[model samples]
Target: MSADAFIAAGPRPPRAGAVATTATYAWRGLLKVRHVPEQLIDVTIGPILLLVMFTYVFGGAISGTTGDYLQFLLPGILVMGVLLTSVASGVILQADRAAGVVDRFRSLPSWRAAPLVGAVVADSVRYLATAAVILVTGLLLGFDAGGGLLGVLAAALLVTVFAFALSWLFTTLGLVVRGASAVQGIGMMAIFLLVFVSNVFVDPATLPAAVAAFVDVNPVSHLVTAVRTLLAGDPAGADVALALAEAAAVTAVFAPLTARLYGRP
Candidate 1:
């Protein structure tokens, strides 16, 4: 075909098979974790420390006993744990940018966003592992799901889905900021404010009126409330709906934005 013929043919869509390309990159991401085992420590240690300190030290003051507080705190802690882990996605992307990985992806004949999609897939695995650790730790600490097997499973699924959606937000930030330390610093500040001001450690009613109002509308609060309802075997009501809506909104906004900015990173 002549160049003129090709030009006349109009711009062809970048070859489709994004699934395989995404899987390949996802595998690369997993292997990175395997080679650098220390990367796993970030997700593991923080949750454990939070669980131990909260259940042992503050449990008595907050819930009258360790057992009671563990049950009450477990769901909230799970939400916080996954949110913290979400920061890693951004950091990883920042590293990839600095290492010229993004530039290589642009030169390759793969779908423009395949590597990012693959990263997102790998992140799902990471998020699932984090959720599993949280559940097992909660169980070992004497927290039981009154909502039974089905309830716990549903809650876990919901959280993993939300985590996937949330990852896109970080991915976009990585593309925009182009610095790991900057992403980490911003992520830490945002995560801390979101995690602390919500109903994770205490009842919202106990917060001062202005703070409580912010928590009431916070997306993390909705997620924690949904998880707690599921664990307690209570009706999820609209909490699950609200949480899903929040996740969908985030993914809808960030996923495409990240894809568009992937080449720039």
Candidate 2:
């Protein structure tokens, strides 16, 4: 056939196998990570610096006891670390979409879920690293996990699941937003609002009545409290379950929204 005839023919159909798509996306994500080792540094170093600064600078004023303060602050830091790492999802998604990577993926004969699933799976490494650094920093600052090793592991897993859910929310935002800068600004604002308004630095009771009421119901506060209770060997009350449920609900709401947005022309 002439070159023109060959060019006129359509491209081969994409393979629709689930396992193949998963593996392809997984490997692609891993390869991207290998090329960008510096990404890991944020996960590791950010937590360390935050933990140290918070414990040393404000520990006395906050808790009147550094040890107890570390115990309380470390869990908040863990949640913050995971949330911080989640911002990268938006950043990366924005970059990919801007650079036409998502378009290229759409052109390919791959599973629709591959890109999203792969991104979340790969980003879990960052979440894990951040969690580990927070735990280590807590240890160095004399914070102990009163619930023992299993409790610590469970808390880490909880944080990871939360981070994964957050990734979906941010990914949708990134994909739908006009540009990366907008995504970053919005994500940062959201993070700051969630973290600061929660019972992260101060006891919610000490706040103004209106602020206290809002903070008491903030999901981030519930997550931080849950992590604190788990670390301090206290009861895992309804708060923890509530936080997990909220995170799950967020994932459910955003996952389909993202999928629909991503699938659109």
lDDT of each: 0.89, 0.85
lDDT of 2 at 161: 86
How do the residues 1-265 of candidate 2 rate in per-residue lDDT, one tens digit apiece? 9988887797867556877787768677768768987878878887899888988899999999778788778899899988988888888888998899989988887788788787778888789889998897788778878899878988898889888898899999998898888998999899889999999888888899989988988888988988888777778967679889989999999999988998986
lDDT of 1 at 235: 92
Q: Write the per-residue lDDT of candidate 1 for residues 1-265, one digit (tens) a residue.
A: 9999988799776675878888999999999999998988866777788888889999999999999999889998898888888888889998988998789888998888889988888988888888888888889888889999888888888888898899899999998895899998998789889989999999999999999999999999999999999988999979899999999999999999998888653
**With candidate 2 superimposed using the best TM-score fit, by how many Å does residue 90's alpha carbon deviate from the native?**
1.5
Clashing pairs in 2: 14-109
TM-score of every candidate: 0.92, 0.91
Q: In candidate 1, list every pair of residues with a backbone clash.
A: none
**lDDT of candidate 2 vs native?**
0.85
Residue 13 lDDT in candidate 2: 72
